[model samples]
Target: MQHVPFPRSVRQKASLAFILVMLLAVGNVSIVQFLLREGDGVAATLNVAGKMRMLSQRMGLSALALHQYPGLPDLAPDQLPTLFDEAHDALRLGGRAFGLDIPAVPKALSPQLLDVRQAWMRQQLAVDALARAPAGDRVAVEALLRANTDLLARTETMMDSLVVQAREVQRRALYGAYALFALDLLLLGLVGWVVSRRILQPVQALARQCRALAVGDYAARSDLPPGDELGELGRALNDSAGRIERLLRDIEQEHAALADAQSMFNGLSDNTVAGIYMVDESLRFIHVNTRMADMLGYPQAVLADGFPLHQVFTGADYETVQAQAMERLSGRATRTRYECVARRGDGEPIELEIFGSLMSLHGRPALIGIMFDITERKRAEASARRAALVYAHTSEGMVVTDADGVIQDVNPAFTAVTGYSADDVVGQTMNVLSSGRHDEDFYRVMWARLQDTGRWSGDIHNRRKSGEEYVERLSINTSYNADGSVNCRIGLFSDVTEKRRREASIWHQAHHDHLTQLPNRQMFEENLRLSIEQARLGGTSFAVIFLDLDLFKDVNDTLGHEAGDQLLRLVGRRLTECVRSSDLVARLGGDEFTLLVRDIEDPDDIFPVADKILDSLSQPFALGQQTVQISASMGAAFHPRDGGSDSELLRAADLAMYAAKEQGRNHFRVYAAEMRESVQVRQGEFARGPDPASAPAQSG
Candidate 1:
C-alpha cells in the first residue's frame, strides 16, 4: 500500500511557531522604543522650560534687591555674577530644547520654547542694568524693575504654554501606543486561531484516540489528514493501538502480580508499630497505614475519607507545620523533623515527633512522614528540665565531689560565693578552700558524722580565691551505689558573711550610744555590778563616779542639736581619756555620764581622776565655726564604804552629784555621810522659802 507524505515535520512546525512569537516580541519592543523616545523629548522640553521660568523669577528678585539696597553687605558680592551665569544657562537649555546642542525636542513645544527664550533675554538685560545702577539712581532702578517684572510675567506664561504642549504630546503618544497595542492584539488573536485550527485540533483528535487505546479500545482511529506533524502523530497512534492490544493480555498477568505485591506492602505497613502516612499535593492524606489510623484515634474507614494533614495538628502546631511545608516546597529544606502537639479524633492532644521528607507518591508531589507518639517521653523530659533548672538557679552554692572530696563540678552560685570557677577548682581537694581556722579534730568529727550518717552540716569558715575568710552554712551528703559504696558527695552552702556582720552591727548599736559610741546606761549598770562583785572578792575598792555637764542644756538651746551632739562626743572622749583602760566610762542618758574606777586604792584615789575629768571637760571645744566653753560637776562613791550593791552605789553617787551642783558647778564632791542629810535639808529648804544669805547678794 502507498502511504501519503506529511506536509510538515514537528521540527518545522515548532520553528514556525517560534518565528511568529519572535515577530510579536519585536513589534512590542519597537512600539515601546517609540513611546519612550517621545516621552524623553517631552520631558526634556518641560525641564528646560521650568528652569527658564525659575531663572527669570530669580533675576527679577535680584534686580529688586539691587534697587532696594545696593550696599555690598546687603547684596552678596557674587550675586550679579551668579545671576548672569544663571541667565546664560537658561538660554542654553532653552536652545537645547529645540535641538540647538542636545537631542531634538518634540515639535509641539517649539513655539513655547521660542517665546521663553525671548522673555528670558529681556529679563536678563533688565537685571544687568539694575545690577550696574548707581546707589541713589531711583529712576534707573525703577525702570529696570518694571522691565524685569514684565519679562518675568511673560516667561511664566511661556512656561504654562510649554506644560500644556507637553501634556498634549503625552496624550498623543498614549493614543498611538493604544492603537499599536490594539493592532498587535488583533494580529496575535488571528495567529492564535490559525495555530489552534492547524495544530491544536488535530492534536486533540489524536489525544482522544490515545485515550481510547489506553482504556482498552483498540479500534479507535484519529483519521487525520496527511499534511503536518499532527497527521504523522495520528498514524503513530494507530500503530500504538495495535501494540497496546497485543500487550493487554501480558499486562493483565502483570497486574495480578502487582496486586499481590501491593497487598503484601499493605500488610507490612499495618503491622508496623510506627505511624506512616502519605499526603497528596493538596495536603490531603491519600494513604495511611493502620498504625497511623490507630495512632490518631481514628478507624481505618474514617482515615480513608481523605483527611487533611492540617487537621491532624492543633491550631498553633498547624501553623508551624505549614511553615515547614512551605520551606520544603521552596527547596530551602529537603526533610523536616519537628515535635508538635497533634490532636486525636476525640480532641485530646498527643505529642508527636514528625519525620517528613518531600517525595513523589502516585505521580504527584507529596510528603511522606512518619509520626511517633512521644507524649510520655516529652513528659519525662519536661520534668527533668525543671529539676535541672532549679538545681542550676538556686541561690545556695552547690559542689559535686568524688568520694575522696576532690572537686568535680560546681554551679553558678558556687562561683558567686567562693569566687572560684569550675575550671579553677576541678580536681583540686576541698581542703584548698580551708582557711586553716579548723583544727584536725574538727575535720575528724565532720568526716565521722558523714561516714556514720552519710551527712554533715555545720557553720564552716572557708577562704575564697581572694584569700578573704567568710562563714558558710554548709551541708554535705554522700551518694551510694548499689554495693553500698560511696559514689559522689554533694555539698550545699550559702555565703553568710554579710549576715554575721549585720548581727554584730545590731549588737553594737543596741549596747553603745549611737552618737558617741560609749557604753549605754544598761551596759554601764551591768559593768558596775560586775565590778562591785570583783571588788568584793579581791578586797579592793572601786569608785562609782557620776558626772553632769554644767550649762549643757543652755549650749543645746543656743546652737542646733547637731552642735550639742558634737560637744557631747568631745566630752565623752575627754572622759574616756580620764579613765584607765580597765575602767568603764558610760553615757547615762542625756549629758550625764558615769565611770567605774576599778582597782582604786581608796576613795581619795577617785578625787584626782574626777579633777582630771572636770579639767578636761572645762576646756574650750571647737564645734564647727564656734568655740564652746563647758564644765562638768563630779561626785564619787566608794564601792564598800558608800554602798554594797550597784543600785545603792548609784544612788549615793547621784546624791553627791546634786550636792556638788548645789555648792558650785565645775566642782567635785565625795560621798560624805553628811552629804545625804545636806541634800534632804536643801530640798526641804527650797520647798519653803529662799535663804536670805543664799539669795544672790543685792547687786548694790
Candidate 2:
C-alpha cells in the first residue's frame, strides 16, 4: 500500500496556537486600558465644572461685598477685579475640559457654554465700572450687585448642566467597560473554540492520517470541511493520497507486464532478421540479442560478457557513433538512422544501417538500436552512379524520344550541336529541328525503312536555334516493348557540316588552279575527252581552241611573277567572258588556255569565238600602276575534222596556234591540212632553241 504525505509538523501547529493565545491576552489588556482612560476623562470633566461653579460664586460674593461696602475703595477695587478674572479663567478652563472648540464636545453643550460666557462678561464689566466709580457711589454698587446676581444664576445653571453631562458620561463609561469585558470573555471563548475546531482538530486528524499513511494504511483520510486554510490542506492531502495509491497499483501492473514483455522480446530476438542491441550511458553494451551476437560473429556467451561499443566499430566510426549518441542523449534528437561500418569478432568489417532511439532502461539513460546489413545495396548504388556519370559526360549528342517522336530527354552534347537546350526541346516534336528540306515522300520512305529494320543511319540537314543550316551524321535505333510494339527511339549524332566543307575544299584543290580559281589541266583534259565522245555519239562536230599570250615572258622579266600572275588572272577573266556559258574555258599551264565549244552548227562558228578571245586580250590590262596592252594568238580545230581522240584534237589545236604565232602573233588561224608542214618546221625551230627576236612573243 502507498499514500500521500502532508507536511503538517507538530512544531508549526503549536506555534500557531501560541500566537492565537498571545493575541487574545493582548486584546483583553487593551480593552481594559481603554475603559480606564474613558472613565478618567469623565471624572476630569466633572472636576472642571465644579471649579467653574465655585469661581462664579466667589465672583458673586465679591460683587456683593462691593455693593455692601460702597465706600471701602481699596477692597472694592482689588477684590472685585481679582474675583472677576479668576471666574473668567475658571470658565475657559472648564470649556477646554468639556472639549469645547474640539470635535469631541456634544452639540447640546455649545449653546450652554456660550450663554454662561456672555453673562460672566456682563458681570465683570459691571464690577469694573463700580470699582472705577466714586468710592461711596451706592448706585454703581447696586448695579454691580444686580449684574453679579444674573451672572451667578447663569454660571450655576451652566455648572449644573455640566455636572449632569459628567454623571451621564461616568454611567456610560461604566456600562461600556462592562460590555467590553463581556466581549473580551466571549472573544476568548470563540477563539478557543475556533482554534480547537478549525486548526487543532483538523490538524490532529491530519496528523493521525499521516501516521496511518506512514504505517501503510492508504485508506485513511482527514475529510475536513471546506472554505478555510485547513480545509484546503485537507483536500490537497486527499488528492496526493489518491495519486500515490494509483501509482503503486500502476507499478504492480507494469512489473507484471514487463515480465511478459521480456519473454516476448527473447522469442523475437532469436527469430527476427534484424540485430537488436542496447548500450548504457558510458557506451558499454549492456544487452545484446542472440541475433545481434551472431551478426557480430561472436558467440552468445562471449557477447553476454559485456562488450564496449568501441570494439564493434573502427576508431573513426566509433567516434562518429559516440558523437551522434551524445546528441540524442542531450535531447537534440529522439531517434536517428545512419550508415556505418561495423567490425565483427573475426575482425572483418561489414556495412550496416542502424535505426536508433534514446530511451530509459532500468531508470538509466540508454540507447537501443536495430541494425541491418546493407553491403550489397551500397555496391549496387555505386555501380549505378558510375553508369550515370558516363551517360551525362559523353561527347556524342543523344536524344531520347517517345513512340510518337516527341523529345523526352537530351544530353549536353545535344545542346552543343543543335543549340536547343533540354528545356527548349523536351515534350516538343522532333520536327522542331527539321530543316524542311525533305519532302513528305522522303520521310515516308525513311520511316518505312526504319520500321522494317528498326534502325536508320544517314546524313540529315537540320536547322539550329540561330536558323543556321547544318548537316549531322545521325543514327537512330528503335526500342520495343515485350509485345514487339515500338516503345521509344534513341538517336546518336554528330555535327558534320565542317567535315563536309573540308572534303569539298580538298576536291576543289585537286582539280582547280590555286591562283586563278579556273579549271586546271586535269579538268580540261577530262572535259575535252567528254566533248570528243559526245561528238562521236551525236554525229555533231565541236571545236577546241588553243590560245597563248604573246610576249608574256617579256612582262615576267620586266615586272615579276606576282605581276605576271595578276596579268594571267585578268586574261582568264576576259577569256571566260568571251566564251559562251555553255562552253568550257580552262587554264592549261602558264600563258596557255583551251576552250571547248560544244554543239557547234558550223566550223565557221569557232572563228568568232577565237576572234573574241584575241580581241579581249588586245585590250589594256592594269597591272599595278602600269597600263599594259597585250594580245593572244588563237587557233581553232574542229573535232572529227581534226583527229577524234583527246591527244589528236589537242595536238591539232596546238599546231594551229603556233601557225598563228608564226604568221606574226595577236591573230587567229583555223587549222588546215596545209598548215601541218609549217607547224612541223616551227616545232623543229622551238625544239632547237629559237631566237626570242624571231620567235613569236607570248602575252603577259
Candidate 2, 565-597: lDDT as tens digits = 899899889988987798988886678788888
Q: Tens-digit lDDT track for model 1 on 1-700?
A: 1385322765666666677778878888998898887677657655655555565566577667766776534332445445444444544443343332334444554565565556556666766776677776777677766766776676676567656766887898889889878888887786686577668888889888878877879978888777677887788888788777668767977898899888866776777577887776666777788888888998876676788868787588999988887777666888999988888998988888988888876666778777888898888999999978978999999999998889999999999999999999999999989999999999999989988999999889999999999999999999999999999999999998898889989988888988889998878878887888787789999888888788787778787788888888988898899888998898866777888888888566777788788888989999999999988887888979999988778878877887898888798888888886777533321111336754311100
Q: Against the hidden reference, what TM-scores do the models get? A: 0.35, 0.39
Candidate 2 local distance difference test against the native: 0.77
The TM-score of predicted model 1 comes to 0.35
lDDT for 21 in candidate 1 is 74
Candidate 1 overall lDDT versus native = 0.77
- Which numbered prediction scores highest in TM-score against the true structure? 2
Model 2, 691: alpha-carbon shift in Å?
9.9
